[model samples]
Target: MSWSVDNTADRQVECDSVAKQVRSWNWIVGGQYRLVDMMGKGSFANVYSAVNITDEADLVAVKISHEGCEDTLVAEAKVYEKLFGLKGVPRARIYVKERRCGALVMDLLGPSLGNLKDYCGHFSLKTVFMLADQMISRLASLHSRGYIHGDLKEDNFILGRQETIDERTVYLVDFGLAKTFLLTNGEHIAPKTGLNPCGTLRYTSLNCTLGNEISRRDDLESLGYLLIYLHRGDLPWILAESVVGGDEKRRLMADIKLHTPVKKLCEGLPDEFFAYITYCRSLRFDEQPDYARLRLLCEVAMRRLDYEIDGIFDWTIRLRDDLEWKRLLALEDVF
Candidate 1:
């Protein structure tokens, strides 16, 4: 059957229906963590705020797979195990399968880039560059571990809690779709076509939209699109969402992404932005990306703008102002 807009709508409704059908339980997991309020929900799992039973002060995020979807959570746990101890990667505490459902406990993180962007309208150039450097580094780390984050979107990258040493750090999460790009013998996997698209339509790479096998380059390309969207508040192909047929919308977006000149997409931004996208598009399926060079482009942009590469992001400033506003409100109340 030809894909239509109804297909996408039906999928969303199905997810919501599934979420509503899944009963929430305050059950204890691993005899240490107790599930509390749900933090988020996805197609296959629900994430809840859990507390360590023995240490009430210890908080974590528990991701519990829906019944019959245990393998998805199990696969994600394996990816986290491979990524353990890597900077910008969350640490997994435990993984358990009980009653046909898998649960994974990990560090609780702050709001996602998507939420922050919504709060601030659009990020400043300085903030974008700051994020670009760190985000590129995070992807490089994942790639070095022989894995590619098949899904790269603003929601997958989150910040650390406020006032902490890692507050400014951008951590990549949600490895449910992660896969190795290398074979067991350390050889690069051969590229293939006719695969299903693996990421969010809005932020997926052109190659991904074409149904090509996802690789490190696809991840980087998706990141480029994400960075641009964060700064510009939208992309040209965003309008494609309103198109009627799902297949037609996808093709339209692919054409827009393919034909849109980097100069036009990076309009009003520094030349480095263009360079970043161009370089990502130029990489071969098996070739290793120049991680250092991509990072250097961001650094160079910072220098050109005379902006200090100090980690104080737009959200940091917003947080400070919010705190001060609350303090003044308290003072007014006392008066």
Candidate 2:
């Protein structure tokens, strides 16, 4: 409850348990397009690089279905179709047109945030704040249409370089588990049910992990965790010990499932940034982050990094290219 790091034994148990659970699910490996190479693999699905037969020169990323998750995949495909090419979110180029394999195709964006994280250990406070602003803006757009990005994590966020110039920009993707907020005429139409409490445990918020409620605030909470992780390179709590044994892993998962709140894993950060994270975490079901407030926070963070990281600092506009990306990664490589 106090948000201290976990001991080694606890972490081992948690890891082992997660591994066992993953063994039971069915993972599919093919797609309608010619699968070239695996992009990434998660607990439930696998993303692959493929080439479309209809247009051989064009490339696509196909997400295939797995066992115990066909319905969720279908629902996600529908959401993508409805929200395709909408600003702020990745456009799904193709939905599950061939339902038999349950594959959805989308623009083959470059490496994900996970790849960037591997290249750049943890980001500076300024970079994280900027990313938070972008994520919040995207969330605002989604909430306006009554949808919730149930899964928001590093793997789901994509970063790509422009063709003419290597400018790295962020793009949110992976909606296979996204949820639709059941509403009608701006009022609740019915209570939605049957969706799993899915999402990486560390980044998920207290309300979402427990209450089964989805809202724009839920996305904000996740964004807070994303910022914290980007700055800290660790989850709020220590789990190294839990990864050792199966029983301990289950206990950890159960603790998470029961909504046993973890402390702000972002200790020792600057007060202003930490306060922003706390604000994001505390948002209620109906609450949302204020864009103007977020912009101010970004400005404050940019000022704080005016010395050591000043070379990469540009608070006036959003980051839309790979110069910043290369600089950030270079810092990580050397540091």
Candidate 2, residues 1-335, lDDT tens digits: the string is 11233344554453344334324433222334666666765544566777866678777787765444467668877887767666656567665634234566777777666776776667766667666666667777776667888778888777653342323456778776676665556654343343335566566665554435566666777777777787788763447235655335434654653443333344577666566656766665566457568656766766776633332423213234556788889999999
What's the CA RMSD for each of the models?
2.5, 8.7
Candidate 1: stretches off by over 4 Å:
1-24
lDDT of 2 at 170: 64
Candidate 1: residue 224 Cα off by (Å): 0.6
Instruction: Please give the lDDT score at residue 16 for candidate 2.
Output: 42
Q: Can you give the TM-score per candidate against the true fold? A: 0.93, 0.71
Clashes of each: 0, 28
Candidate 2 local distance difference test against the native: 0.61
Q: 221 in model 1: Cα distance from truth in Å?
A: 0.9
Off by over 4 Å in 2: 1-32, 54-56, 97-99, 161-167, 188-196, 240-264, 307-335
Per-residue lDDT of model 1, residues 1-335, tens digit only:
12342444454564454345344544788888988777887767788888899999888999888766788889999999999999999899999977567889999888889889988889999999999999999999999999999888888999997667888899999999899999999999999987667778788888988778989999999999999989887998999979877778878988998888889998988999889989988999999999999999999999999999989899888889999999999999999
TM-score, structure 1 vs. true = 0.93
